[model samples]
Target chain A: MATAKDRAQAKAGSGLNDDIGEQKRLELYRTQVVLREAEQRAYDLFLQNLVKGTSHLSLGQEAVAAGFAGAMKPGDLSFCTYRGHAHTLARGVPVEKVLGELMQRDNGLMRGKGGSMHLTSVDHGVMGSYAIIGAHLPIACGAAWRAQYKGDKDVSVCFFGDGTTNIGAFHEALNFAAVWKLPVIFVCENNLYMEYTPIGDVTAVPQPAADRASAYGLERILIDGNDADVVYRAAQIAFDKARAGEGPSLIECLTYRQSGHSRADPAKYRPEGELDRWKLRDPIKIYRERLLQFGVAERVIADIDAQVRKVVDDATEACKAAPPPPLDIIATDVYADGGWAWRN
Target chain B: MAELTYRDAVIRGIAQEMSRDPDVVFLGEDVAKAGGVFKATVGLYEQFGPLRVRDTPISEQAILGAAMGAAMTGLKPIAEIMFSDFFAVCFDYIANEFPKSRYMSNGQVKCPLVVRTGNGAGSRFGAQHSQSVENWCMMIPGLKVVAPSNPRDVIGLLAASVRDPDPVIFLEHKSLYPTKGEVPDGEIVDTLGTAKVLRSGKDATICALALMVPRALEAAEKLKAKHGIDCEVVDVRSLVPLDTQTILGSVARTHRLFTVEENPRLCGWGAEIVSIVADEAFYDLDGPPVRITTPHIPLPAADILEDIVLPTPDRIAETVRRSLQS
Candidate 1:
């Protein structure tokens, strides 16, 4: 097997520290644990009819959300797809607010108006979690355009699946961003499947970023998304280039979903032995093992895990206790009631 | 006051707004260099340069959805959709994304933008190129639909739409682009939900919008001079915040309601107006509300077929006379 240093140099570029410091490693591990445990608890809640609507769990994709969250600066806007619970939590939106949103409570992120599929937090720079596939890509470019026009250094990040690359909006948005030299990052979490169908079956090329990046004149980088350190390092490279006005970049993260597509799906379409192999390379386990090798004590890791469980537990309890939104809220917020000619 | 075409009025309205607000921008296909397909944005590129007045590729999805994002991020964008029939190319963005962002976000974000597109059928652009789907837009909540009949109303409504803090679907009829009328020199912003009374009478109330407004006025004049029957014409400038109160008052006096539109008769704007009159002024109405509209079919490329299918001033007058006899 190749040494840790060799693997790091191959995946995350040369001359970088193979092992992250204890503090950062522990933070990454804790974030993943919280995300994984929270999703599992939310799934249980969904089964018991506590959380309404269908929620897509990101069981194996926690590391990507956590890593991107770590690298993003304050006020950097980001958008994600329906499978975006972990992305919201990773952005520092309280677990109470997220779980409350899923449960449709008054204290939810959007005051219970937007359910699981539409989580948004302008305060945390998590713009929206769109349910329509490949629709929000153009909106991200628009945000990037505003940032560029105002001379703001903040970069807009759009996280989507491998399937979104095939839509017409994807090509339009990418082409516009390239032509305008907008400051944004397109992170394609290539989880190998677009819903039930393998991406290879639908996409013309095996690797979407590598195939189409040159056509748009954008820089392409592929990384092992399960490795949090590698993801953070690669994202930094793209962010620096974008901040320097070098234009947009595309990063293809190779990862997998540990569970089915949604709350009700069984994912029987997945090939045999594929799940077992991917489970062996679970992101949380990989990061934990790497942290152990970095001289972090076992007891410390265990303590962090215990603390994460408490946070998830408390958040769930809070969500359960929250009240539903009132009926009068229906007529409110549809338009800014500014004494217009329409609002007679 | 100066006389200007409907096209020039559109340009003047947008230009005036752009000069008033630094954040107002214009983006569409050929809007910068080619000065728009209808020449509605002529001379803006030279005045605002490339940044404020941008010419995007033939991507309606990008133009519309990006306008939503830009509006949310502190820019008031006026995006052109080329033709109202092409809204299907970016319907999801207009219907699902921008319209609901404000409500779904609990009013945290607002899309202060105008989606300007040419609507209605008269120039024989064929089925796909020519359509008056204003009713289709009126059905959607969170979207304000406005169609002006002349140069003055076009300028006033366009300016009001840009200044408003929501998504406004400003529908411009293709046939009215070259129609000339006197327009006030300086800023003339009109209220959205207020209908204009083009003519006043007591025999019958004729409600019309867009291209049908002038035709309705002509029908009213004919009814007066020929039949000794006076008709009042109410121009529905705004479709969403419908000025039903004005229509109700006119219907009460005239005791007869007749709606005229250029769109298809089935489930069209005229149907909505008749329904409102039925509900609010049923006892006051002397007869059943009459709707004069085009037949339910795609507009043919030939001018003869189009003219036969569309509602004309004579047909409207005959409908009014028949209603009065009843």
Candidate 2:
């Protein structure tokens, strides 16, 4: 645990100046806020176009998504769960395609069939996400297993929520990855609540889900997920170690969700004091102040914000004008050639 | 033609496929150095090395997923589950993901993954280990299900499963592993979903799958030799994409129907076949069809208990007699 004094002094030891890291943190927060705004704009467009189903957004828990995504390598594969739009954006997916998907455009990532839960782009090494919780972890393990078998230096990443940590698949994946020395990383984004129930209410071991990884002979690391610099640096270190064939790592990011789990619920259960404390620890302001301290021109940061906002605006407009998937899409893509005939 | 045991034939088939195609690989628990608990993958690790013959952790999903991933990437991967019951852990991946991938990708990709598992209620493995999961897998749309009755079909079907463009669940019976049979010499490439007439008769058409095929044939022989029933027995080589024409055609000619399956009666694979054949050839039938299968219950561990639970030749003969009487 870094004290106020340690945080002030230790920042200089890791080649990460207190000022630079703070700026990086702020930049990430601002970027996440922009992503949230874009999500809302896309939602409005979805209302007009009404393509498929509901869209999941990371309105409050923006820091961890951006923080972890900023640290990934080009060849590294990321397997996400249902709430994956922020992770997608953080990994550099353009808002246009992201929103275009919400509108069911042919230009969407998965030809609009995936909606949000199944976002993927193999070009970016972004393995497909699934609506089924913790299911993709085994796939990540499999990819890592293949990499190790082929002597490839690639690492696989699995991102899931606190609720998914309890799934049987998650335990199975972690245990297997640990035993086989597979280069896979498990990230548990602990955002206080799982849908409506608080983590404390649901899990016997509260907070720092990474602790569970240690039971499988793997390293478990926990961090303030709101801090982008901390997340990026920690993720980079873990990926480097895993890619070196050291085995799997479990990283639990402590964060909070601003909205309900999805589009339907409004969270009235959170205590005001706890929410206020988190708001005060706003990673955006911290990074902006640090960036100012580092003599980064405010005009440059302002321009970046303006550019992001404009792109989201354009994406919003594009989604509004985009067409939905054809009705006949339901009947197609069931099987190739209907089926194969087997004869003696 | 070499006389090979069922288990030896499987190892030979895997060896042949791995040797024939560099892209073909084997994966399972202890499939490498241990050469499998049943020695079905014997000498594979030494031949192909560990990279090709992988020994994965005791996780059904990981084993199945490795096969799925390898197959999707142009590798013909054969993944073994130590027991058929363990497949329940990865039903979602095999049923939902691998099978649906080709269709979802609009046929751009082929899932050349073979999930080889041993089924049936024997070996005193009790309720947990002993299971007939063929019927469950056959219910899936994109997956091709094969239940081999003998060593010859074991090698032929496994080789075919490796070459098939779709995912195949090759359900081998645990009891049939040491059951020796004469495998036809030379390359055997039998197409899937083709039913072979093991016995030809004039009175009735009897359909059976997996271990029950031999039992049904034995019953058919008894009926012919003793009562002059002369029942024809059909071995349904593949369950999914069933040979409805072959089944219905025989029923159309014989005008009597019977089915034999190792699984439980209610809603088993037999019921589906019965429904399909009934809908197609009901008016052509001279008697009501009968299904000789296990009762709806988990298999017992004791041999005596299992015998009572499993479908026996006497029971199949009785069912065939009742079908003729009806």
Candidate 3:
């Protein structure tokens, strides 16, 4: 990994505007590795019956979360869909708390209240992970609106699947964000499939989110989500534009999900060899090779890989030992008073 | 004290909050510059300026979703849904997003916001535009529902709802917008989950909300003058954090209960009140608790049909008179 001094030197030497210094590239690579390992551990926990309810894994789509989260500054908000394990982990939330949430334990991110689909840590600026499709897009716009209203330099980044672009809230939020010039970035992780069906089957346009960008008077942005470098450059540009008060940008990243939509899905509907074909372009695999090609020491790559494995392992053990939340918590937090009583 | 219209009270209430807290923002379609479609929000845009008082495109979901997002952060936003009927379009935010955010996040996120909508029927806006949907909001847990009958209550309760940490659905009656009432000077902030006894009587308890409050008072007056039966009129203001104590006390004193509701008959707000009264104050009741409500049918544009369907003062007086006699 490049040190701060090395990164500064590299930035000084490289006159190219789009060059993300060695430090940033290494940071993105490390984020992808951590997300990938943590997500794989979550899958393993599900297989062991430790994880309760359903879980949505972003196994093959680490680059999108890593790139966007890396580009975002502190106080910037992130709103994502249910397939949000990667996004949550990428925001610097501990692997233990996230895993504990999946296990429905007292040590969970939300103390087992939110469970798998609704992971939220306001302290981390991960606003929420919404279960409903296209719901958080408008919410992200609102957060951006708040930032704009307060004259804060922070931006809001929203993530969703390709299916979300087809939802009514998507168009509503886009037009609202554009007209208001809200500092928000709408990132569509077009992972080929929308739940069980291929996005192309139901979507009217080829690039679901980007093609519809023109309708809202936004720039048409589409990129390869498998490459962390490409995604990082795009995210930085969008973030800069939003912070400069140029309004929201809609970026559709073409990617693929290696796992089924959720724990219950077998993903048998995927065509033969589709998974195999996507495996060649796997985000983590590509990022690791890219790091080596960029002259990052082999020892540095091995060290990060080993460190992430240990983190995931420790989180798994801790989550396995963590007890379920107390029954008394069931009625709490319904209102701001911390009680569920609707009537006297 | 000075007299003010219900519409003017809305502007005053919002202005009071906005002036007090820089974080409080107001948004809706035509709410800014255009002064809202109903003209209930006149002078707010001019007072607060464009950023604080915003007007959005006709997008209900975005309006509500944005409000929830803003609230989840550090802002106390007051979003107008224009008509209460449009809640159907953005029901996801009301039912799923706003109410569930704090609970689902285990108290990490607090949505201290107000969604004020023009509710109830009297303007002959037809089925789509006209609806007394406070009952729709009352059913959802984690929400504070408020429907003020007069200008004073509107300002007081709107102030209260804006200050409340929980999400509040403030229902401003469209019919009562132009009606005038006395409002005390200064920042009038009231409490949620409290009902006021508008007119006290010994014979019977007349429970009402929003549009029904005025009609219930009129019926009470006629019942006292004609039948010599004094009825206590109770304004059931906040529905979610229902002031059951006030209602039960009124029922206990009167020993009879009657609810006048403008919502459809099946699952109206009156039904819940009646059920509670029947269960808790069963022995106190001298007769079966009666509910005078709009028939389970879509409101029509015609004035005659609409007036006949909605619970009127005459119908309320006749129903109370006949029920007491039997």
Ten residues in sequence with the least summed lDDT for candidate 2 chain A: A6-15
lDDT of 2 at B206: 86
Fnat: each model in turn: 0.61, 0.24, 0.83
**Model 1 C-alpha lDDT per residue in residues A179-246, reported as the tens digit of each score:** 98888899888888898888888888767654678788876567787888877777788889889998
Question: Best-fitting candidate, measured by DockQ?
Answer: 3
The TM-score, computed over Cα atoms with residue i paired to residue i, of candidate 1 is 0.96
Runs in model 1 with CA error above 4 Å? A1-10, A13-23, A338-343
Instruction: Give residue A311's error in model 1 in angstroms.
Output: 1.1
Tell me how far the alpha carbon of residue A96 in candidate 2 is from the true structure, in angstroms, after superposition: 3.9
Reference-based lDDT, residue B247, model 1:
91
Choose 1 or 2, whichever is better by lDDT. Answer: 1
B1-326, model 1: which lDDT tens digit per residue? Answer: 99999999999999999999988998999999999999999999999888889989889998987888788888999999999999988999878987788788777778899999999888988899888989888877788999999999998999999998889999999999999999987898888888988999999999999999999999999999999999999999999879899999899999999999888878898898888788878999988899899888989989998888888999999999988986
Colliding residue pairs in candidate 3: none
Candidate 2 vs candidate 3, lDDT winner: 3
Global lDDT of each candidate = 0.86, 0.76, 0.91
The residue-by-residue lDDT of candidate 2 on B149-196, one tens digit each, is 998999888898888777889898888888899988877767777888
In model 1, residue pairs whose N, Cα or C atoms come closer than 3 Å (at least 3 residues apart or on different chains), thus clashing, are: none
Error of 1 at B146 (Å): 1.0
Give lDDT: candidate 3, residue A77: 92
